[model samples]
Target: MELIYMKKFLDACHQAKRITELMPKLPERMTPRHIHVIDALFQLEQKEDSVKVSDVSGFLGVTRPSITKLLNELESLGAVEKIPDEADRRVTLIRLTEKGKKYYNFYVEEYQGWLLKQLGEADTEEFMTTVNTIARVYKIVSDQKTAPVFPGEE
Candidate 1:
């Protein structure tokens, strides 16, 4: 049973690594980090009038400095605009520019097509069953509030 679990865990890790490697191949004007930022921006775009750097940093689980750097790069590329909040002078809000929206749409479409091609080659039923099982396991793990024990952890 333990060996079976270990084999499944390693296989899942390998699949995750492969997916990570494939993400950078998408057509986008930014790095993976920047693309991730754009994704977040898109999520917030409709929910709120604008998003803040701190909001993105917290949502993405990234540091303020890293978010700032990404924002600066995005700004330079004319992909996003930083608008000062009217209520607070200290707060700077972020919004996608037209160019950013166009690029994001292109990136999403290309990525979906790529993934569909990859998954289409697999046995659909088996692949979906595996995905559903993994989703259930992920939900179970995520529902636990405490930190999980790792090997050699005290």
Candidate 2:
């Protein structure tokens, strides 16, 4: 039973990946990872007065340097800007530019329209509930006990 379940899960993941590949291409110099960062920034913006690189890094469970590198690319693309915090000049905060907001809106509108068209209102709601259940399972598996890293192992 578990083997069958695992196979189905793996197949679903592959299908999801293929579907993403089929989605419309992003603008030049931008990729799916950039969109993920943009989405993270958008969500964090709603909850916090100011969003920091570390906050994004934590939210995405990625390294700060990775977030910084993506931010630099987005900055070059005029989608985001890094500004010094007013209260503390040493700390930097990130904010989406007008372009970023536009892109976020576009992506949301496109995805919602596509999903609704594909599944209809009732089925779309059910599909989302299933997806949310899978996400919870993933989080549980990721949080499973693991051996602690030694001081030098990393």
Q: Which candidate achieves the best TM-score against the true structure?
A: 2
Model 2 residue 59 CA deviation in Å: 2.4
Stretches of candidate 1 off by over 4 Å are 1-4, 24-29, 113-154
How far off is residue 8 in model 1, in Å? 4.4
Best candidate (score: lDDT): 2
The candidate 2 region of ten consecutive residues with least summed lDDT is: 107-116
Task: Give one digit per residue, the lDDT tens place, for model 1 in 1-154.
Answer: 6799968876986887576566746445567667778888888787887799998898887799999999999999888999999999899999999988876776655675777887667788987887887767677776767658777973
> Which residue pairs in candidate 2 have backbone atoms (N, alpha carbon, C) closer than 3 angstroms, thus clashing?
none
Deviation in Å, model 1, residue 45 alpha carbon: 0.6
Provide the lDDT at 111 for model 2.
70
Instruction: Estimate candidate 2's RMSD in Å.
Output: 4.4
